[model samples]
Target chain A: MAAQKNNYRILTIVSLLLLLVFIGFAENHLDLYIVRILNVCAIYAILGMSMNLINGFTGLFSLGHAGFMAVGAYTTALLTIPPAIKAQIFYLAPLIKPLDQMNLPFPVALFVGGLLAAVVGGLIAAPTLRLKGDYLAIATLGFAEIIRVVFTNTQTITNGALGLKGIPALTNLWWSFGAAAFTLVVLLSLINSSYGRALKAIREDEIAAESMGIHLAKHKTLSFVIGAFFAGIGGGLLGNLLGTIDPKMFSFTFTFNILLIIVLGGMGSFSGSIISAFIVTIANEYLRFLDESIKVGMRSVVFSALLMFVVLFYRHGLMGANEFSWERLFGNKVYQKTLGRWTKRPRKGGYAG
Target chain B: MTLDLFLQHLSNGISLGSLYALIAIGYTMVYGVLRLINFAHGDIFMMATYFAFFGIVTFRIPWFITFPLVLVLTAALGMTVEAVAYRPIREAPKISILISAIGASFFLENLTIVLFGGVPKPFPAPTLFTDVVQVGTVAIQKLTFYIPIVTVLSLLALLYLINKTKTGMAMRAVSMDQETARVMGININHTIAFTFGLGSFLAAVGGIMWGMKFPQIQPLMGVIPGLKCFIAAVIGGIGNIGGAVIGGFILGIGEIMLVAFLPNLTGYRDAFAFVLLILILLSKPTGILGEKTAEKV
Candidate 1:
């Protein structure tokens, strides 16, 4: 058992080293388009995983992700852009106060964005946590729309609909993929912890969870704050990567894209979300070439069709709740192919929690 | 605001409000029975305009023939969507059903995008609906008068149907308790399908009027209206039809009043419905007319 554990550890380190080396090589040698697409995949993984933590693991069904991302994107964009660039972008209504003068490092800006989003998430989550299911969904959606409306109207702060321009190209593959990896490790550990058990308990039956002294509000708030934090990180990466962002970018459709990822990947599966985020983003680009090849927005036609198919027929999706662990790959196992269930023996020395 | 300006906005608000009410009645009927938000409803309404557009513009059918044809076709389309997107997931978790509705809505939107392209097409309003009329001091489109009349008539007809007819009783019975309804020998499938068809018929009326009022049609135009009408219905109480009309009028008038009083906030017009939605959610999960529902463990 000790030897197997050591092997898993060694294998993990070696694979991570290989991944870093590959990223370094790709950054230097691959086509810029490929590298950019790769960065998008990583950012999407971060967004998808965060959404899954709330909507899937915690069973919150919150649709306010795009709002949180907007907060993060606008915040990070403001902080990271140079003072001169900020002045130029906010020509319609100059950057408010210290924002015009103060500029921060990319990493710091990303953290601040995440912090602000987490604060907003906590605030929104408190009043909304009392609601459940569809009502909760609508309330969160309302908040997201309100954030968008305010962002659009507050031209001085968000630069309004004109959007920020000349944003520094600070998001490299390293920052994006690194953030994705960090999100994965943290979220994975959270899911396996005692609090995670409590969250899953709340999801299964809220009343029963309350009866078991799970302190539903505390666990719910914790998940919401954490989810918003990582989503903020993802948005910051996206903003810097694209070098421009408007309030329009963070519409409900943006949330829908991540929703598709989690649904296709299997909502409760962290690794599955990461995997499907790559698959769906890559597949969508390629699928855009179908038939007309020139018309925009045609890709979503087939994409939504596939989504409907999954929702109707293969509801648990690609991985269901089963995670991708090396133990399962190495264990002598019979494939229980009755359908979407993947039962497995459990073992763990849970994460940092 | 001057009295003339206030009266002008009021007339416009009443027209828009009635349009919203016209659509919300259908939305509430389906919600009352199925308890699903029918996210695709707005899309279905959008499709109605296109049907009328093609009938009048593309094929050059006369207004009377095209209008009735559009209603029938829209009702059929709604029933088809219910069968395709909803029927299979009838027994699934609430989230799945909601997801399915969203997917169906997206499919319809994207499908329209692919088939019709995303450009906004000018709706061909018949002279009867769009012609100008002088209401004392205000110049009002004939549609302004027709809309409220249609809304009130539809509401009265719907209330009469639900309260006075056998099918209406079946709908109420089914909504109250599906198992008992089934045991009582109600054909659950047919009744649900009929409700979808009827609700969709009303939405078609709103869509046609909306096309005349706005004078343009696009693939994605249904999204905002769909959400707002749903919000309006929620404010009126989801299960109550009469409440939906009141909610619609409130939303419509309130929106006009907001812009009239605060001209700078016009950009935030779309956000107005969502703001109202949040306030209602906070103050009353059950709207004025909504009955209290206990959570069953």
Candidate 2:
């Protein structure tokens, strides 16, 4: 067992080194389009993982990620846009007082955006977490719509439907990958800890978890807030990457895209989410041809069809709530049994001869 | 506001409210039987308009023949949606079914967009419904009168069906306990399909009337109204037909009055439904007319 543990440790170290090398190579060698796609994948990975934290790990089934993303994106955009740009964008209606004068570094703005989204998540979760199943989904969906509508109407702050432009294109592959990496590390550690166990217990059986002395509300809120925080960061990164954002950009369709990633990945597996995020982002870009040749709605139709197929045929998704572990793969009894059968067959044949 | 203006708003509100009521009934009935929100319900409503549009415009069919055909086709489409998207996952987890419903809704919306294009098309409003009737200083469309009468008649018919029909009893039993109903020899799938058919029928009627009154149709037109009507169903007590109608009227009138009273906030009209939904969820999760039922472990 100790030897197995040592093997896993070495494998993890090797994988990390490989990933770092790949990132470095891609940064130097990849074309602009490929780099842009990679940045998008990294951002989507963060969003997918965050959504998985709430809906998969915690089993909340919340649909408010887009709203949280909107908050984060708008906050970051407002803070990072130069005063001159802000002035130009808010020509129809003057910018809000403090925001008009404010300009912060990209990192600080992104952090603040995430922090505000977390605050909003906490506020929303306080009352909403009491509900379960579809009610919770609808409520969260409603909150997301409300947030969108507010953004659309609030001319002074969000510039209404005109949207903010000239945002600094600061979200390179390094920043996006770095943020996604941070999210993965934090989320993986959290999921392995006692709190994660408590969350799983609640997901398995709420009454049983409560009887076991777990505070349901507290743990649920923590998971939700944490999820919101990362989702916010993802949104901020997307805004910076795009260099332009409007209220229309953060519609329920945006939430649906992230939901598709997590659902395809396997709801409860962090590694699965990371893998699926890249697959989905690339698939979306590749599927642009279908949209252009056929109709704009073809891509969405294909995605929704895929979602239904997954839900109906493979409820457990690709990973089935299991993490990828090299140790487990090599040490599997099924693998050993198959190997034994193969080796024994030749010897048996020789004896017969 | 002057009494004359208030009367005009009142008439407009009632017309909109009755249309909302027509749609909400479908939501409540389907929820009652399936315990599924049927996210595709809205898209089904959207398709109904498209069906009518095609019948009248593309096929050059007269209104009298086209309207009934649209309703029948929409009903069939609803049942097909259930059979295709929902029936396969009837025994799965509730969340899976919900996701499937979302998928189905997405599919329908996008398919319409693909086939019909995204641009808004003007509905061929019959001269009869679009004619303006003047009373004192108020001018209202003839639909304003016809819609409420139609809503009341439909409500009565629905109530009669639920109370008097064998299918209604089966629906109630299935909703109460599916396993028990199955044991009692009720064809659960058939009843669910029938419920969807009925809901779709009502949605078709509502959609037709809505298109005529508004005279503009688009692929995404059903989304907001569908959401608002769902909110109305929730407010009135999901699964209760009368409550859905009442909720619809309340929501409709409330929305109009809010805009009238605070014109500056007209932009936030869509947000109003969600705010009301959140408030209702927080304060009274069971809704106004919803009966409390304990979860059985």
Candidate 3:
């Protein structure tokens, strides 16, 4: 067993070193388009992981993710944009008095934006955490709509519908991948901890967990706030990478994209989310030919069809309820080709709510 | 506000409310029976309008023949959706079913975007409905007067069907307990499909009226109205038909009044419905007329 463990350890280190070498090579040699796709994949991976933490692990059907992302993106944009550029963009109405002159470094601005999103998440979770199932879904959806309306009206703070441009391009391959890696490590550890067990218990049966002496409110709140924080950071990274943003960009459709990633990845598995993120985002770009050659919006037709196929036939998705470790990772390729199932032991009836 | 203007607003509000009531009836029926939100319910309403648009504009059918054709097509579409997208996953987890429903909704929307150009098209409201008459300083479209009558008549007919018909009894039975209904030989699939068809028939009526009132149509037009109608259904109590009509009037009137009373806050008009929804949800989680259903372990 010790020898097997040592072999696994050596494999893990070798893979990590190889990944670093690839990133280094790609950063210096890759074309702008390829680099941009890579950056977006990492950001999406972060959003997917965070969303999966709440929706997949905690089993709370919250759809307020786009609202949180908007909060974070707007905050980060306002803080990082120079005052002169802010003046140029807010031609209709000058930015609010407080935000006009204030600017911070990219890292600090990102953190502050994530912090604000976390605070907003906490406030939203307090009232909404009591509801369950479809009711909870509708209520959270309502909250997101309310937030969007408020942002559209609050012209001074958000620049209203005019949006902000000329945001500095501070997020690169390093920043996005680093954040994604950080999210993976944190969420992976959390899922393995006792706290994660409590979350799983709550997800499986809230009343049962409450009976087992788990504090439902506290744990739920923690998970929501953390998820919002990372989602905010992911939003901030996306904004910087794109260099322009508006309220319309953070609509429910944006949340739907992240939801798609988690669902495709097997909502319960972070490893799956990370892998699926790359596949879906890359597939989306490559499938542009279907749109360009045949008709506009055909790509989405393919995706929605694929999503339905997965939900109906492969309800467990790519990884089912299992996670990726060294043994599973090495075994996955041969096993996937040789067998239909991902694991030797098929655990039936476990689903990501 | 002048009394004439008040009367004008009242007529407009009621017209809008009745349309909301019609769509909400469809939403409530599906939600009440399957315990699914029918996220595609709104998309189905969107398709009904497109069907009518094609019937009248593309095929150049006369209004009288086209309207009934649209209703039948819409009902058939709803049933097809239930059979293809929903039936296979009937045994899946609730969340998965919900996901499938959302997927179905997006598929319809994007498919429409591809098939029909994204540009808005004039809805071609018939001159008969668009005609206006002045009554004591208040000018109202003839269709405005026709809306409430249709809603009331539909409501009565629906109540009679639910109370008197065998199919309605089967619907209520399946909703009450699917397992028991199956054992009782209710033919659950046919009954559910029939419920979808009936609900979608109502959505077609609502969508046609909405096109008349709004005077223009686009691919994404049903999104906001669909959400508002769903909210109306929730407020009225999900399963109660009467409650849906009441909730519709409340929302439609409430929205107009907020804009009228507070002109400065006119920009926040859309937010009003959602705020009302959250308040209603928090105060009465079972909804205004919904029964408290105990969660099964």
Per-candidate local distance difference test: 0.90, 0.91, 0.88
Write the residue-wise lDDT of candidate 1 on A105-212 in tens digits: 999999999999999999999889888887788788888988988998998898888988888989999999999999999998998999899989988899999999
- Candidate 2: where is the Cα deviation over 4 Å? A1-5, A328-353
Scored against the true structure, residue A214 in model 3 reaches a CA lDDT of 98
Candidate 2, residues A1-353, lDDT tens digits: the string is 46647867898899989988888989889898999999999999999999999999898989999999999999998999999988888999999798899999999999999999999999999989999998899999999999999999999999999888999998988899999999999999999999999888888888888989999999999999999999999999999999999999998888888888888899899988999999999999999999999888899889989999998898888777988787465556786577645532323333431
Best prediction by lDDT: 2
True contacts kept of 3: 0.78
Q: Residues A1-353, candidate 3, lDDT per residue (tens digit)?
A: 46667877898899999988888888889998999999999999999999999999999988889998998898998999999999999999898888999999998999998999999999989989998887788888888888888988898888888888999998888889999999998988888899999999989999999999999999999899999999999989999999999888888788888888899999788988998999999999999999999899999888888888889998877887788787685456676666636444323463311
Worst 10 residues of 2 chain A by lDDT: A344-353
Ranking by TM-score: 3, 2, 1
- Decreasing DockQ order of the candidates: 2, 3, 1
| Residue A214, model 2, lDDT | 98
Better of 1 and 3 by DockQ: 3
Computed on C-alpha atoms, the DockQ of candidate 3 is 0.78
TM-score of chain A of 2: 0.92
lDDT of 2 at B236: 94
Q: Give iRMSD, candidate 1.
A: 1.2
| Residue B221, model 2: Cα distance from true site in angstroms | 1.3
